[model samples]
Target chain A: MTRRWIRWLPAIAVPAVIAAGVLIVPLSANAAVDLPAKTPQQVLEMVATTSVDAFSGTVVQTADLGLPELPQIGQTAGSGSNAPGTDSGQTASIAAALEFLTGTHTARVFVDGPTKTRLQVMDSLAERDLVHNGSNVWLYDSAKNAATRVTLPQGDATVPNDGSTTIQTPAEMADRLLASVGPSTTVTVGDNTRVAGRPVYDLVLTPKSADTLVGSVSIGVDSETGLPLQVLVRARGQQSPAFRIAFSDVTLTAPSAGLFDFTPPAGATVTQQALPQSNSATGHATMPAAPPTVTGTGWDTVVSLPAGQGTSTMLDSPMLAQVTTSVSGGRLLSTSLLNVYLSQDGRVFAGAVPLSVLQSAATGR
Target chain B: MLGALAAIPVLIAIAVRVTSGSSSGRGPAFLDQITQNGLFVALTAMVVSTPLFLPLTVGVVAGDTISGEASHGTLRYLLAAPAGRVRLLVVKFVGAAVFCLSAAGSVVLAGILIGAILFPVGPVTLLSGDTVGPVESIGRLALVASYVAVSLLGLSAIGLFISTLTDVPVGAMAATVVLAVTAQVLGALPQLDWLHPWLFTNYWLGFADLLRQPIAWDSFGSNAVLQLGYIVVFGALAYSRFTTKDVLS
Candidate 1:
């Protein structure tokens, strides 16, 4: 009898495992555009085809970004790289920007003109999922279960690495170095190709700063695949080297509108960020901000308020440990390497963020 | 050296934290840290000492290499010795360069170690808009670091060059940093686009260029050559300047 049951165990377990997998499958299969598997063009196709409803994934791809290291050349420049996990924010933002630009992550980018308007929607470690839509931006920081919105400035070098709509993370600042790439910028083919099984071309951008830096960018593409493989930003003259972003595991599929869709929970708080006009969220909607309560705890302005409303909190104490910022908005309130936080309240939050990400987001803002 | 070493971690932590920006992402972490982040305070701390350290290291060496002799009134005696001005300058320049490298290296090593202790470093997981698997980050980061080291040769040379131009090592070190910063700020002008090609700092970015995917060897090589040229020119200039300058200390 035991032997018979044991044999039957395989049969029973097979169905059980299959059922278990079936349950597990749906967890990562959100209708969101977390498409780390799709190439840039494929992602564009996904944007073109997907309906306002279906599509999504939990995929993440990394490509080898070939950016030239900036040269410190003739200066006493180096931000100091001795801190360890301390730069986690900069690291995350840089990663996010790279992933978004290279299409290593799922994103919805809206460009109005060649150099005019742009917006990018993606996730951030600090603010959870965020949308850089025009001058108005929103974040759903699920961690703090809050939401925030910010009306940003344009034309200024507000964010790091972001020329128009994209932004750098806190750790992204770690990429700042003293390289000697001068003001002359050009695009050229690169040799360190073949990342994510794709071919790449090098796009070298010289620094606009008068600093003795050598800035270079290597944009890799998978030739046969015609997908962006990576983007590397280098500054050789800095005491510390620059940063790189690479893409791995790309797929092709149209993402449903649900990927960009966000709704505040019933009881979540919301912070509107004193901006004009709502996000015009085309899909399901979120909640509104709670009446102004004490904005935050005694410390931590970058905190989440009730009703998914978020306030930028940098709670430092004789009080906070570090200048740790907590963004509270929508369902996305969370800590970020950079001070900018995203929350679920249909808002974007940023206070003294990195210039790279600032540039990226600000352009959109 | 130890004080400088200590500053590296604090700076790294500040770099990591302040640059981490608002739960907001995408920008220079440093600016975020300084402008409106907690890391600013830490960075402030680093900046305070940074200015002092550069001079101290170079000063100690310069004083030992030059002033100490003067203080002992052995300037004439040393001049009387077989050491040519060029040889004396070479020895000091090389010594200062090595010190600069060592000082910078100390910070980097401390930073990585502190990173291991302070944060997760299983692999150097580079975060793009997407993410990298845990297994692959280390090798890539290692490559990144190597490139960084190569690129930093510019700064090292700058320090060396400055050291040779001045009998006062502290003055040399300070002057080097100032020149570096000035060049850095000036290198960004569209109007000065003409001047960029000749600037050595233009070549300092070669290491970062290597991080590009299908890394652009042509540009990278070009950048490397340009930087190498700058180093050689600067190095030679320092050599010549020091050899001919009369030691009046």
Candidate 2:
């Protein structure tokens, strides 16, 4: 009986492990995940090296509205909304929620109809980018000339901001969106369509992760130049409130440097409090080592951080286009409309991977 | 026109809940559920509108019932005979209550029929907390219709109180409708919540609350108890005032 049972255990064990893996850990932290990395400089060079035609179009947005009984000023609670600790609706679209994840940004989104347009802005929002710069995970505030670290409410979690992270540059957003999905993401080609004067490839990004926030995403690219012309996001949970960023007025040539500088409207408060900085400040850094591979998967990189050791940004479905990337312990995760940021102390004196390789090398140990 | 007029608001409330507000969602409080519950809807419309309008109809009958007889000198001839003054007053009060109750009764019966035909029944949706399913809508509507009955006590009390004051029933009936409306208007103000505990209109407001999701039992329970108190006090006032008043005329 023992010998027969032992023989049967192997078959059951594999399926059991697979089920356990899908449930216990979040999809963002797959140990055997790998992405191809390209640096900001490298990303810029890729853009500089390519030639594309400029297409002028308009962006449109449709929003659904609902009204609920509201608590009066200073009234902490009201009759209709009595669920303690749970907000009646989602808060993914609040300006404070996504203010930090992005640097200076821009994007051009095409609405469904031909005649309408919408302007999506990504200027240096004061006090918004303090945390990212202070934490040194990303950009410095152009106005403050100070490293910005996004400040989070003591115990609250954040969603990734789609506009700043995804639309910083046309190429960066496209590449990041392409990289965020994994091998499990299914790909398909759509009906031939033309935007501007160029034909484009239509790519849909479905999360390979078992639990993905994105229900569906479609990107229209300039087939001639490989540049993305438009992107659309469909998410879950944001029934009453939805997020949409359609960029119009595409200017490839710099808009006279003054367009990026942001000055606060007069009388707006500028409260500055220096953030605590340390070498291990991100709390997501680890001693650098060579990227490793999983035992069975064919991917080149393996990020095998133990459970509860990483911070990640995600766009939870209800608030489609709303994104969050967080880092805890030795793992960092960031999400933008275009790119997913994952990094550790990839800058080691010996056998360390490059910072840009973090997302691609995740499949490697 | 009167029947259709009173039926309209109740029906509108029911249709609104069915059309948009959580279709199968968290049900309204016992008060709010009335909006969806067919029987309560009918009862509410009948109770409220009849008090304001039907009394005038009753007054026309009453005004003629007494003064027409008095104009013919039947009261003087009858007073000279064995019939006592108290019996006449008693009969008048009873007849008026019966008439008012019967009119208001249509609100209840109509509410039931309308609720059965229009609302999805059986599982009751609670206003604040949920204990609802499709099957409860019927049973829940039936339960809430009782509150409308409680609301009608004021109508009868006012009618009876005024009926004792005069032989001309028309004047008494018109005066009663005006008093009821004044009370209701006073009760409707937002600032009245502090005084709602004291107002008889509090019971009328109770029926409206039944339409809210997750039936609020606390409000319903309190309204029911307070409503009984109003009936007892108001009934006693009408009885005492009628019993002691001059009847020689």
Candidate 3:
């Protein structure tokens, strides 16, 4: 018996070694190590005080919004002068834009102070980059070989206002979650974790209101640098996260100045268009016009615009028809990250909460 | 195999160039934007061909290697010639491997010709948003072609073994294609993700890693090793089965 077993050992050993070679993938390079814990308030204070800005990293944004099927973006006209108010076209563009926002996308991000930032979203062989350097902003889509340059209003960069549609980074997202830390929420220290190979402390915030569908929002703040490495959001009753944005790899050193510089690649189709000028006397460049109004605030906030506002040409698109279904009083497109309700009453309501939350807002407001 | 090597590349080159030239309106989402680059066209041709066309050709060639001789009553005569079963199987495997490499090489050659004529050849932009010089891009294309060809070794071995079991070439060929498609289908299912790494076709698309700036060796290395594993195990199985079998045909 011993001799027979020895004969088979070589075969078994070879396969076992090969299997190990294929299966062993480390989850994170930063192994779990002992780190000091801090209170939730201390974590929030650290986030507010963190000065490690002007860094570059690769971020992956994933939205699980419980979507039935991810919408496929078909042939889009290769021009940024696209009309924004047309019905079906707008809907198609919105749907296509939303598609880019949902999937697990890898983006290279660079932040050089508050006014200068650059993000390049990589899609297969194509790239879409957004660079905001002071007042001059450029959005370039290499897939279309098209570039759109817009100059923001002179003082728009200094204004402390909301409703602007500038691309949101992980730090801004952490700030948004932290700013909502008020009387309607309870904060606590959750776990000592590692993010992007850096030791971090998680601060968990739970909404006090039962009317809100948000279960909890946790921000992982780097212990030493105080920069938020990740922000995760989960809706009520869901086990997995609905939306997550995290740096897979990050560095605190300031990125180079040329990284934010933009010169369209040779042969790219350039469309020079100034943003809608504010009503000021000079009538110079202004911030892109803000989208429709939002009713209510905090976790239950509902952003509603006219039904045909940005649905553009996609209103009657068969592609749109395929991904969304009509519900009781509206057409509901649900993904793991957020739900959008387009009602027959000629209004589109969208929120991070559930359809029920949107419905309540639709009825109440 | 020679016929495939001669005919398939020209056919694929013409087809890819024509489709790329005319599909300006609403063709594939990305290829239209990159129509100006020949290297991209060649890369596109390889990607378009790998899933079905190349595999079909490989299946037929591998499937016919042994069974075609048996169906013609040549197996016994060949066995009588003192070229033992193990040696005979090895020769057949070498022939099938040569076919796989040359067939893939033919497509790459055709793509290069068409791309050079129909589009501009210059520094190529990789999927990672970094650009590599023309020489490096060609090297990456060669790497991609090699990876694709090597990835099919497991399929070749499987088809050769199946061919040994049957005297009808068509039946063996059909079995090989069906099994290849089945592995692909299983790999596509999200619920069966755990089974993917073990599947023969799982790492077939790992050639895309060559298009990355730094060249992601993680997937590329695993894929090469996995296919090697498949070749060794299946090659041994074929040797064991053929050596003990009776020459009844």
- DockQ for every prediction shown: 0.01, 0.02, 0.15
Query: What DockQ does predicted model 2 obtain?
Result: 0.02
Error of 3 at A170 (Å): 4.0
Cα deviation at A127, candidate 2, in Å, is 39
Give the CAPRI class of candidate 2: incorrect
> Can you tell me the CAPRI class of model 3?
incorrect
DockQ of 3: 0.15
The weakest ten consecutive residues by lDDT in model 1 chain A span: A73-82
For residue B222, model 2's alpha carbon misses the true position, in angstroms, by: 4.6
- Show the lowest summed lDDT stretch of 10 residues, model 2 chain B: B22-31
lDDT of 3 by residue, A1-365 (tens): 56545544544565676667655645343446577767777888899999976888878887766654242233244222344444444443445555645546667788888888777665544466777788887777665566667778887864221111223567889988787778878899776788788888888888777766678888888999889989898887778798888997887888878766676655466776645532221121121234577876666677876545325334456666777788988788776546788777667788766788888777876
**lDDT for each residue of candidate 2 in A316-348, tens digit (9 for 90 to 100):** 322323232344322333222122333434311
**Tens-place lDDT digits, model 1, residues A1-365:** 55544534443454466557657865544323221344434432332343322112222322222321222221111112212223343333333333333322322222222222222223221124454433545554432334555556664323112212343321122123112223334334333334444333333344343321235545444443333435565554333224455543333344333323344432234776533233323110222345322221211222223334212231211112222234222222112222343443334434322323322342343
Task: Estimate the lDDT of model 1.
Answer: 0.39
The worst-scoring run of ten residues by lDDT in candidate 3 chain B lies at B22-31
Candidate 2 chain A: 10-residue stretch with minimal lDDT: A65-74
